[model samples]
Target: MQYYKKDKDKLVCLLCSYYCKLKTNQIGICGVNKNTGDKIECLVYGHISALNIDPIEKKPLYHFLPKSKSLSLGTVGCNFKCPFCQNYGISQEKNIDKSKYYSPKDIVNIALQYNCDSISYTYNEPTIFYPYAKDIAIEAKKHGIKNVYVSNGFESKEVIDDMVGIIDAVNIDLKCFNDKYYKKELGGNLNQVLENLKHFKKNGIWLEITTLIVPTKNDTYEELEKIAKFIKDELDIYTPWHLSSFHPDYKDLDLPRTSLETLKMAKKIGEDNGLKYVYIGNVPYENSTFCPNCNEVIIKRNRFEVLQNSIKNQHCPKCLYKIQGVYPKMKTIRKTGFAGSFYPQEKEEILKYIDEFNKQITINGSFDTRAMIVPHAGYVYSGFTANIAYNICKDKKPKRVIVIGPSHSMYYEGASIALYDEYETPFGNINIDKEYSNNLKDKYNFLSFDDNMHLEHSTETQAPFIKHYFANTQIVEIVYGKMPFEDLSSLIDEVLEDKENLLLISTDLSHFYTQEEANKLDNICLNAIEKKDMSLFDNGCEACGKLGVKALIYSAIKKDMKTKVLHYCTSFNKTKDASKVVGYTSALIGY
Candidate 1:
């Protein structure tokens, strides 16, 4: 009960829910608030824990102007102790013994010099470092740089009330809606976080939310729907809800990685609930916003690099749709693709895989896959199938490639593009012209370059082959999971018309069926794809990305292209097991 005030002899610790009243020399639940000599001065007011220049999207903001650079600042100390704390290393660390200290004056100068539009208080709870954040925010405001706060959103109404004038935008990470999960797992209350979100919105601060979709923990469809519906109803459909992919890090190691499928489901839940802007982060996707009305691609992106932007004066060029965010000048493809596979991940080992895969594909020719159909699963299983597909398409050195795939790895909206300017594939750097991607988003409603797709392997797996063949080219990436076939075809046919635009479909066939049954099931979808018959294909086709396949089929037919299957095999053929098997296929689509 460390609680003390400056007035006479009374003291109160209002740092957390467990408010402890004290006389002198007592502490509160978070252990930082102390009763000291009848005066309550924040002990770690000037202590900054972490700082960096991060993309605004990394904060999981969709509407706060994409690609805006943020000056991120964080300080140690948090009010709650959650079990699945991603930043536990710093949040629970009492490492005041180490690290250099900087004053508020120093921070103001540094933030100004960094050319940041705003200062984001992130990484750890800014509420615990309230005094310092507030001080820096005040100073930053004088320089015309606004303040942005990224928090767990569990602070009191009073704490949120104080941030009113200073914080221009806030990214609130809502852990859960259930009180049991809040109390047992997060060591907080649900009502508190919800109240703060409404408070930020009511107070007229730009608000965003991020929810890490962890495996077997908070990834229920019901929970996702609830969260999405609440945001749509209370915060308005335009409030961007970032569904981030979760890895087994910190203390949550037993949990498997969040499947891209789960992330897709979450996005669907958001859209189903009428959320206008939804995105997936920490996983790769082609999030180029398209006009929800017209299938015209408003924004063209490959990872972080923006390629083709048709958004003019915030209105769609094709459908006259009003756009959002800062629309920068269009970017050109510098060099794209060149992704390698294999990894326990030493840079050298990863590079070697690319080299080997390239060598195998290069024996054929140089027109390699401008776009490819590769497997996203680990190389040991589907490497040969994915490799052969690349080999067949290695003749065309198209400059821009669009790798489309079903999201088995993370949740995302319409399609998400990785924000990385260049993706590496041992072969070389393939520029993902970020400016062009942003322009694409400006022109479309459903498209955006979300950070979530950067490390997504499905599209990345195809890069090595494209790089091995093209070797020195720039490319773009497009990632999507669920949508109508017509929408996919409409978008692809529009952007990928140039022969230089290589289009790839990375998908595995059937999953978890016996080898024989899988082959039988996958062939049905494959036939439909080859015949360019979208209507014949059913959702039960069970192919990971049948939608993308069917969309490609329609696009190919529209162009009168032929479908060439370079390789088709089951997981059983690639492995010793024949029982529980998946399927793989690599096809060269051509005119």
Candidate 2:
């Protein structure tokens, strides 16, 4: 099976929103999906893990048909292994048998017998079984059968375009507004999912949203408000916002279920945020749809059953209020946070960083060069300019690698040695020499833990590209704030003398200054490094990780290293206004 476009030889699987790019034969984040050959085929294609005849309203799509029946089908594998997975048996089951290949024509004919209004590709990520679903959709459409998708909404724009016209309605699960929930619980990017929702709207599809309030996981009042505001502003106020109560399952079995009070509060948040058609699900409550204009019960419902509908030609029967979700303007333009349409600058900046990285390869110190200095902000804010020096640190192969970065979470003090044996990136995981780091920690004052390392990305992000080029590598991560530069450097020198070692120092330049101010001040620091003079650095150099850079500079000078500037960037390039900028640069030091 093949999926994912190549990211510098490492393949990214676009079968699901996780879009995991495998290294060699490794599977995606979903575990079962893989990109092994020429085309990205779902390994479980036609391998229907579960099948059912469900009510159209079970999909919680109130706008389509009040109470229609649909044939719902699902296959194994999901883009994310969410802790509160409702259908973990089929979603997580790894065994694949093609016995479920009921053929596209067969599926369509069966659905027709039951007079199902639609055939839904749902349950365990429809995108994972794209090949089967696409085939089934083609046959179903020929028979005048509609198709629907219940997805996590984390899709690449390219993937969505390929299936544009075939999809009729989609109910995307908007997990949370915060990135931490996405990174920690969902194992995906929140912004990427938000992008898919926008793409659905742009490409023409019926879109509704659902958010399962998993107690503390994503049911906070702040989170609820953010989500409501996002849907109202970004996807449109007329977009139906469904807040479903959650009962613990899967890995979160110990957690308590979300209270009905919480769901009610969340609905209030959505209504207060200007969402016209807010509804609650998964609890015993009124399912009537209220009109934003007259506050009248426009559409009455009982459980997943609709009782009486007051909408006439899609307008409120009483007030004749037309909503913006479809064609009529809803008096509001969606302002979806990062959920909003990507400001092209975000993508351009990342590409700019890659080009600058290639440029870094153009100018260099050499094979024996071992020291480095870099930045640790997002690709938009610092990446374009951060790869200048890191790209030049190519020495064929290194026996070991040491990456030092600053502690940003504020919980840990001084420095901490990573505990995980491997670190990952778009490229792959770099196996860490635990024994080496453990021994080194015994030789220093650093604390070591896996949890702390997981919370930090500065050191982790730098390891992959380095490992990609340099094989037979073992990595060590050091997260420090203010440690003895000379002392740290001395320990590094001792390690290098006995083994082939490479150093990676991550620290952005100025903090929140304008591009002009950052350039003026950061230039002084860059020039000082070019001169190999640590004393030239002023005290006002406001890099959040200044201590890390200062230590690298001191160590590089002590080791008699040479320098080169690879790239530079400021957040002004990422944000609409260039008034405030965060500076980042890539520099190299080698003997």
Best by lDDT: 2
lDDT of each residue in 282-311, candidate 2, tens digit only: 888987877778888877888788788666
Off by over 4 Å in 2: 1-11, 23-26, 323-591
Indicate the residue-level lDDT of 476 in model 2.
76
Model 1, residue 422: displacement in angstroms?
34
**lDDT values of the candidates?**
0.70, 0.72
Angstrom error at residue 451, model 1: 43
lDDT of 2: 0.72
Q: Give a tens-digit lDDT track for model 1, residues 1-591.
A: 222334446576554444557567765555456677655556666667677987666776655555567888776667778766788877777555335777877887787677777788888777766667788888876555677888888766666677788778888888766888888877678877777788888988888899988887789988888899789777777687888888887778888888989999988898888876677777788666666567578766544444666677667798887665444434332232223334323446645655676675534333333335566666667777777765565565665677777666577668776556566665566767455566666765667666555556667766666666667456667788556768777877766666667777878888898877887888887677667666667744677777787777877788777766666777676576988998887777765
